[model samples]
Target: MKRNPMDFMPAYFTVAFVWFTTHFGGGFASGRQLVEFFVQYGWYALFTPVIAIAINALVFYYAWDFSVAHQKFQYRSWTDAFYKPYERVFSNLYDVVFNLVLVVATAVAFATGGATLADVLGTPYLLNTLVIAIIMFILTIYGANIVRAAASWIAVIVITGLLFIYGSNLVVTLPNLMTVLNEAPAPRGFWYALWQSIKYAGLQAALLGGYVAVTDVLKNKQDVKRAAICGFILNAGIMVLASAVVLSYYPTIISEAVPVVFIIRNGFGGVALELLVSLLIFLGVISTGVNLIYGGSKRIVSVWAKPEEGEKSIKNKRIIASGIYVFITWSIALMGLIPLVAIGYSYVAYLALPIVVIPVLYKGITKRGGEKGKSNELDAMTAADGPKA
Candidate 1:
């Protein structure tokens, strides 16, 4: 039976949800990054979500268009599309920056996962990091299909569990919600607040490009758009819910590095809550790790492995590349190099800002204009694919 593209649209939504949730892991969920950008500014911190959503919408819009036009469903990383236009200076810059960032991000995730495991299960951080890396490596080596299956199941459980936890906190802290909002100090000024919001949102969207690459495989532009919008809504809702949960215990959250864990401990003291939170955290890290490894491996394999030419098998090459990455990331993490790597990669992302912003603008405007005005190559490709020219 031939599968209709429309039938896969719902899958895109799931893909988007998993993508956003995974990207939102390290800093956004921790509240550390949010605090650095918004909370310090006070009441104005509320605007951060708005800014983040707008940027996310724009990025996803282009990502969907690029995927549909190309008709190539295996774009496991945005750099593939990004390299299409600015192949000379910008593409090279993007490639370098993305790999560098992935290395650091993977390391950070490993470290964080270890720390979370230690906190929740009394396991050593070093051992936990190795365990996660090994599991993630094996999963990536198998391929995206396997990763997607795991992510789909885990996302359902994590989202449902988080909703329950946040909902309970909201009800219990109803009175304090408004007080926290009103009494919080306003940012130093409107401009400072706005810039902080922009930077925070921009960085997140930029990094999320790697995750959005998977959507390229979806055959329908409409599906891509719908999925992106749905994903954006879900992400915003979760962020708001998370913020509310943390704010309920503002004092405790303000000092704690892992606010989500703290919220669980304070709001639900039983072993059940601890176990649930631990599982959610573990799944969150695993989903993100798998996505990162898959993205990195795909990029390397596509460039170096010439399976069509019979030089190497793409699948086997991908497995080898993924293993190498996992080993390197784990080794760096074991050496306690996560912090320095994270900071360096952040700087590299700043450098790659131009590469991301330009193509995103081009894709959005051209795609929004309709197929007639699209580039000649894209129009011909779409026509060949029978998308109604």
Candidate 2:
């Protein structure tokens, strides 16, 4: 099939954006994650949105650029593209950690989603896992395009509703907003706030990198770059708005598992609020599930596809691999390991920082030495590794 370059960028960007937003799952939707990381810091949470946006932007920018560059050279995956440039003991360590992290993340998603579904619907968690696992398997077996189409429209609706709810509260509660802010407890020190911001940003960036991997399908570098920029802006704006809404209802939000729902119920009341919250949470869970299945399945399949070696007939292999992955994920979920894994993986994500930072750092150092550095170092590395496929 002849590829259409024009559709590539938008499609890729859309997929990437869906992946990014959905990465944090129920955490992002409920604001509990933010509360855990930022709100506890009180007024220090104000700087979090800014630091997170900047870090995410930088991470996405580098990942997107590297993906496009390496894809043009026929690289099949980020690991294929980056592993060589960063070849070392630590690079191998990163590969092991990265792959393990991906597996653990998908497992956690399945577990948590199952738990949430069971809790909300009053079904057994195992039943929920069975159902979600089947659905995820079907969606992932098809590929990224199907995943993108299924999620894109639903994501738009959820994001729009969230924005409306948050925006309305910002306006209606504006008169008392300052009072709420003043009453909020402050952080212990500037250093604490700084560390909190870095932690939040680093965690978010690691999650965002998985999203950027899907951008390899994008034909237009400009579209990928533009989409990332716009996506970061949208994310930052929403985070800020959410933080404000959260702080407005501060101290009270401390006890809420789902703070966004709390804000909606308190701000709007009645059927409108209920319906919006329901839709928001549903879409949030569904989009996130789809992305996890897609990314996890793709990674599993790619390991065996061996594009460089001209392997074929891997479709059956991919399906089987994906099924096993879903099975393991569902099993762990049924065992109620999701929350523990999610919390553990948050730190494991820090393990990815060195992997991501090294390439960008190398790029910077090479840039300083002009063409000589590139010719001696990067080109040599590329020549030694050869083209990916």
Candidate 3:
């Protein structure tokens, strides 16, 4: 029996959710990235996400090419194909950049958690972040897969909570948003907005590792295409709405460490919704931080620990590596969430542009978007053939 096209809709959505969840981590979930990249730029922020969408989707479409076509799912092997003959240098280079990405992303996660905790608990910012850091260290040193397994569902739940909160806020404050747009300053910030969007797109491109790492579920170019298109819609649409929510309050929203949290506490939603979302943000960032830290620790174990040495030695390296990252991220998180989003992510963008974005764009354009010109296994497989007992 031929499978209905809709029969595989869920699978395609799962892939799209992978991209969304990776992108929607601590920084995004906190609503800080929206403020930094779009809301701060004034009314033009309304349209900046479109520019960002183009840049991001362009990178995503081509970045997935080498991985999907060649069945390179692991980050290292995937990079081997993306950079091709020069994988020797560029792959090693990307490895460094990705580790740094892990660091910044985790640090941002801690910072986000701290901010959310402080808002809910009225604790000291430093103390909250430190506590969050310690918890992530303990959690990450133990395991990773369970959290990775939950990320997709986390995306769904957190996104639902955000949509309701932001959407309701939009409804309540629609007039405010409209007033801001109409009275939006005459300067019409253009170049600055686009530059921020570019920076944001480049910074996000750093996570191409996380995104492509899961493309194993995608069958072929068509699967990749639908997933990418779905990604663009989900990422951009939600971002635009979030930015509008922030813009409704304008410069006041600027002061918030976690704008969405601020909105909730300011009486946008009922107490129950606030608590649930708060818990979600707290768990969400911790999970995100732990997953990334554990990934980095495994990398260290692979490099410094020879499996033949003993299981204890390997486990020790893993623990030690987690501690090192925990300390570094603790220090970075001290700079607070805004600095992490504005400064830390900006640096990541600078690193990502040449290493991830430019190379892929070059490869994509020169190779005609990496068309295989023949049927591949991924494209030929039926839905039922993907998994075997």
Candidate 4:
């Protein structure tokens, strides 16, 4: 039965936070993404983020609803159904995109951890990366459920810290922000700025696999609508807010390897807040990397290894998979946070825009959003009627 968006608010927000937390990791925590993707555009930063985010809302709504309607919860199956006729090509392409997302995401998380700590401790960046990798390797070995629960709580804490840090700093930096808006030239121009914004959305599109994977939580089309609306508001809203905060500092803090740490250390807050933000970012790094690493490990084990039907076999492959992926990401992180976000991430966005974002947006607009419009849809217990799919 169709219900109001207001109904099932808890479940809707639960789904919404998944997208928000997924987006709000190392790239976001450091604020480099905002600077590289938006703030660099000068005044254009004001609206471009919203544009990219609007696309994310639409794409996620269609992808998730289509997944629920068709009962293609796993990404591979969904790709087969959604990309039919062209599935032979697009399906394999999307596998490349999703796996690349995991690599970039895990690497960024590691780099964020390394850079954040190295900024404070005067430690070696690669060593810091290894330390973070080792910690995650040990934790993920325990199981997924523990880290999943920890990630939820860390999301709440990170949100609170963001508000406390940025909210206060914005008021103090209002004059600086206004001056930059009036004086700084938007060197990239309007069209180029818009392309960057689109690419930013494309980089985020890589997460559709993770986002759509959870749509089984939506009982009906109403829940899907609510989740999409809430997802856009929270995810886009936070990015815009971060843009505003980072914009206030403008060209000076923009070049910093870690903008959040720069802001806190310079004057935004005292030593205590700096350490606090660092701790939160570290927690986010650990949780995000652990979860993503496990996903990669699981995929490797399930697909190629196809371990014998036993926990022992599966666990052993998982350990090996985790180690290999971590080593790959650790090498990537050595490039430093700025190069990884600006250079490495931009390449992924360019790749994802064509295969992942554009196709998903096309399907979302052209296809029937859900099975609700079908006359021969299934009854309860099937996906159409939505009894837990």
Q: How do the residues 44-84 of candidate 3 rate in per-residue lDDT, one tens digit apiece?
A: 88889878877888788877766677765546656765675
Give per-residue CA lDDT, model 4, range 73-141, as digits (tens): 456656777787788999888888878887888789999988888887788877888888998888666
By TM-score, rank the candidates, best first. Answer: 4, 1, 3, 2
Each candidate's lDDT (Cα)?
A: 0.62, 0.58, 0.72, 0.74
Residue 321 Cα positional deviation in candidate 2, in Å, after optimal superposition: 2.5
Name the better of 1 and 3 by lDDT: 3
Tell me, by TM-score, which candidate is best: 4
Which regions in candidate 2 have their CA more than 4 angstroms from the true location? 1-9, 12-16, 72-77, 83-85, 88-91, 100-108, 111-126, 172-176, 306-312, 334-342, 358-389
- Scored against the true structure, residue 111 in model 2 reaches a CA lDDT of 57
Model 1, 1-389: lDDT tens digits are 11223344355765676566566554554455455556656656555666766676777677566656654333333344445544566556666666776776677667667776788889998899888888888877665446556666776787798788777777877677688776675547777777666665555555543564355445577777777787777777776676665665655466565666776676654577766766776677677777777777776766675535442366677778888988887776654433433364457446545656556766677654233223222212211111221
Question: How do all models score by TM-score?
Answer: 0.83, 0.79, 0.82, 0.85
Error of 1 at 72 (Å): 4.6
List candidate 4 stretches off by more than 4 Å: 1-9, 122-127, 138-148, 305-319, 368-389
For every candidate in turn, the CA RMSD to the true structure comes to 5.1, 5.9, 5.5, 5.2
Candidate 2 residue-pair clash tally: 0
Q: Pick the winner on lDDT between candidates 1 and 2.
A: 1
**What value does the lDDT take at residue 185 in candidate 4?**
57
Encode model 2's per-residue lDDT on 38-93: one tens digit a residue: 67667767667778666767666666666555542112245444555444654456
**Residues forming the 10-long window of minimal summed lDDT in candidate 4:** 375-384
